[model samples]
Target: MLNAAETRCDALIVLADVDHVIHVPLPNFTFQRSIDLQGILKSFLRKALVERTGQIERWDRGTWESFLSPLWKCVVEPVMDALAFSTPGDLSRIFWCPTGPFVFLPIHAAGLYDTKYSAPGHKVFDFVVSSYVPTLSILAPSRNIYVAHNDDFRLLAVRQPPTDGRRLSRLPGVHTELKHIKEVITNSGSACATFLEPSVGTVEEVLGLMNEADWVHFACHGIQDAKNPIDSGLCLANERRLKISDIIGLSRSRGGLAFLSACQTATGDEGLSDEAIHIAAGMLFAGYAGVIGTMWSISDTLAPIVARDMYEHLFRNGTRPDYREAAWALHEAIGRVRESGEVSFNEWVPFIHVGL
Candidate 1:
């Protein structure tokens, strides 16, 4: 949306290459060059998300490579060529705007990983830092908010670990994550932060605190109601949920960033694919300049590590941290996650940045 002088990154609105994506996990899925797109896409989601996802956690390297190679060949390679990127370069950034069913896919992590003797990776991560934008219009108002401001860069970190009787798993890493955050913020001498852990991270309490802070981080359970996207939200204390409707209500001028370290925060409804209905987009519409969201569920073990590194990178300036740096911070943090031996594709690929 920026004029030529203000443009800093390449924007690629992705139209899903069905041949590569739809056929990756569904080898036996019948296809024609010209097929009913709606029916096929819904079927693909049912199989991959519902059927095969049961085994996604245990996917071997062979399976990971098979899917990635096709994804690179069909989707990412063309974009890279058009941008004149033959190999990895420094300081390159791309803002991906994936259209249709592609929103659920991870475009940032696409590369030819396996298939034959391909060992040294040629992944998209090497060439550029990647971020996402729901739409171009969402960017115009965020320019000023993303920059440094006169007021203190206040931060709110919320952690709602799974308690007894809840179906969710416990997040043991969030404790260490809060410790890391405190250490980072204390050393930065700029960010004024508050923590609401355990029994306090309720819907009303979080919204109340969000009013006082410009930037916010959530290390909690995120529920994605595919049938009703409006109900999709972060799981908070006492079984209270902070739905998308609740978030967009806090629209303000001073907002900077919202780091949603929760599952399916950016995964939109397949039926209404073009609409900006997810938590990340809700945060943007709520007036935050940027947001860090996940396309699918994330491992509790890795989320805190990513969050800690992201904040460290953002606040490296030691004064008021620039919200514009959130994308690069997330990019660098996920790079570490990828290199953190024994990580599968699903584990590292879900963490994504949306907005400036």
Candidate 2:
């Protein structure tokens, strides 16, 4: 299967009661397994990992920190050890295509939780920057040509107010996020337009602007419908949901980047986890070359901070704001948050870049 593949492949096949390493004759080759990985994954998922509402619930720092330590020892350490021994060099970027419950775990942030086992260059992040794709075959096609940074490049910023049914709390951070992003783009001489709440942040209105905008940033709440993934969507103004099925129908010929700053935008149904048929992947299929999404719920207060840092890195003087650089920029932005010590797993780890 690896030989016949035309695209870059990284297969992570999970099996029961097996602890071994295997190597395939391919460009990037190495695979390792743990004897209790399947059991451990099942146990981890049952604990506050996923919610009854089809969302992945946030665990308190104490709970998650304790959980991460064992998870790192059992699952991540062995895999990293094998990769380090087999591939000797500076590990730069890796696209993790995880399967089953591994999809829900934060493999990028795997490391020793306590200071006792801590050492330099121990965490996964220290080795290589990580991105994710549902499958290798889906990434075969050339990415959508991005509009160069110039006067003609456009950005659409959508901010939805609290709705009656959902009654989401006011996201003050979202206001700050939009302001900073707009200032950055306008200062760079790129065109930017906003759809504010209680007026124009509707499914139909945003869809109309999607084709013209070079980039789209949505600050709102997301819903994951486990029973019907297509019905899952971002909650817009007036209680309207912009379903995944709706996004897939868009005629977005001029592909661009989409920043889904909402809850559960990247969470997939447990039954269909391997398919990667979630909101993030849906955006890719809808024509965007790159997508920024959250695997679970994130702190509203820290959302803008991450966004500000990300745009700062992305719009730095000499850097080009292209989809290819999205993952690197996001990784650095999360690093900034981690350095600050204000927020950790709940905020920093949830922000991930999918697609190119």
Candidate 3:
């Protein structure tokens, strides 16, 4: 559990059915709504997902536009006001531990969509860098380990081939991504091993190498099984699927990091969203100290760019390569992409860092 004394935030936003409680060192006043806030949140999430998945025909852009006002009024605005009024200084980082349907909402991307108030300094991302955890207890063990600056680390990169009968689009960028990562790590005099298509990229092969790796990067397709969370897995070569159960069963000690550059790797089952039973959390449960993942689908072209920038920032800090600051590195990478104006929401917002 988080120590109230050691908490770095101004306040913690805890959502409930009819109202949300803002915890600013103590349980503060609740924001009440006449409507069923939970139902509204779920509806908003469903609409967002539909638009994200290109199924927006069911609801027009106007309808989607209409939903945002209630979302901001009922869910976001109250929390923002509470933090601004109660907090001592400027807000920098926010750790949103959402529950139930609220978990599916993109709290980091919350903003007024109108162009009048949609400037760079007017949004949530401008206020703070957001980090999420299923529960605060998972943070306890990671605090014990010292993140030493060691360049003698080993990396395992896996890139799956386009499987037949699978809906996954082929990621040609995986080749560029792996190549860039290899060049970066090896140029730093670190060990880098890869399992590329057709032969080496399999569930069995990747699992075999995971224990010895200081970091593991999976550049493939991720499937989220809403019915059975454990069965949700990464699609690899020859139609092989590496499930969450396979990852949790590893006997390795608690250490290292995982970069799941796949779709929905951080998205848990809607039915069990509070449990954080997704592939990203599964990696943590499998003993990884840090994880970088996507909340929804990401662009194939932009994935390599983001990955390249992130690794460059992470592994090439002056002379000493440090992977300990994964979250900061990712935040910078996303900022760079956003500033470039090449890609927007689906490409940038989906990428998130969990764990340490």
Candidate 4:
């Protein structure tokens, strides 16, 4: 960690340097149950992703708040206390690096959301703007780079529909999503050039655009290849794919932010969870300062709304999009969705912010 200087507004500007704290909570306490923390972690993901996922999406309040309540009690809250983050907003910015099966856990979403007796400031997001890294070593390089003051914030936004002969589910909301994003960036006096299906949505075009742009976004169907991590990629037009290998080749000096609205963009291979080889992390390796991804699948209908709110906050009719505000903008957007009470727990928890 390094000392960060404050801006004229007194807000801490995020640095390219990695200033972080890591806490492995298992050794800090003795468990009354026979099960070890490792076993508990294994069960938690299995239950959430495979066993009782339907209950989490459709059950009553008990099931709705199940993972969050216990996670706060056992993992996140204890870490907060050890760090002496005892009040709301004690830390303005924080990032999580969950290893092994814990990568599947929503540490940012930890806290009792439905319990009547829970304190107002019990949630992790209540304390700081949360981001994530698979490991400290991943962010200890040339990331968190920002566009220069003289440069215009050029964004390359893409929306991929189902290509011919592929049975991929369509995201009908992406039309409105790209429209909203374009409107926001245009008002900010920036470029939000978009490419949709049946146009220049090919891999070659996208990669070229990404190289020339400061910001990039993808709203499409994502494919994760557990057998071979490099094969994992997002769907593009003309049956072409943007594989993880492709993203790894990108090292842009002007890289800023990448918003991945596709499913499972943050999910790593189950067999190699400790490595954290996933699309979102790939974007970080490609030199983007901040990345937005989902731990699992998200609602097709709600994707546009989430995108709209986040870009609105990031731009705010300003002259440019502050790539530094990516994490805070994400936190604010997810908070609005969660507090709306119109979405299921599944709909809101999958959204995650990664990197600085």
Q: Point to the candidate with the largest TM-score.
A: 4
- TM-scores for all candidates: the values are 0.82, 0.79, 0.77, 0.83
Q: Which residue pairs in model 3 clash with each other?
A: none
lDDT of each: 0.70, 0.68, 0.66, 0.71
Q: In candidate 1, where is summed lDDT lowest over 10 consecutive residues? A: 1-10
Candidate 2 residue-wise lDDT, 1-356, digit = tens: 11113343233422223465243323332222321333444454456333212234455666556656644555555556645533423556666676655676667777665656445455667667777777765456455355565556667788757444435545556777788887777676535555555555668887888877778898877888989998998877777899999999989774678999887899878778767679998898888888899877667677777777777677776344666778888888887778777665656777888877
Candidate closest to the true structure, highest lDDT: 4
Between prediction 1 and prediction 2, the one with superior TM-score is 1
Q: Write the per-residue lDDT of candidate 4 for residues 179-291, one digit (tens) a residue.
A: 88988877777555655444666677788889988888898878888899878988887657899999989857745889999878988887877688999988888877789
* Distance from true location, Cα of 198 in model 2, Å: 4.1
In model 1, the runs with Cα more than 4 Å from the true position are 1-56, 115-121, 141-147
Candidate 1 lDDT, tens digit per residue, 19-75? 331111222222221123334333433444321111334456766676566546656
Candidates in order: C-alpha RMSD to true structure? 7.6, 6.9, 6.5, 7.1
Predicted structure 2: lDDT: 0.68
**Candidate 3: 10-residue stretch with minimal lDDT:** 1-10
Candidate 4 wrongly placed segments (more than 4 Å) = 1-60, 89-91, 138-142, 163-166
Give the Cα error of residue 55 in candidate 1, in Å. Answer: 11
Candidate 3 or 4, higher lDDT?
4
Q: Alpha-carbon error at 150 in model 4, in Å?
A: 1.2
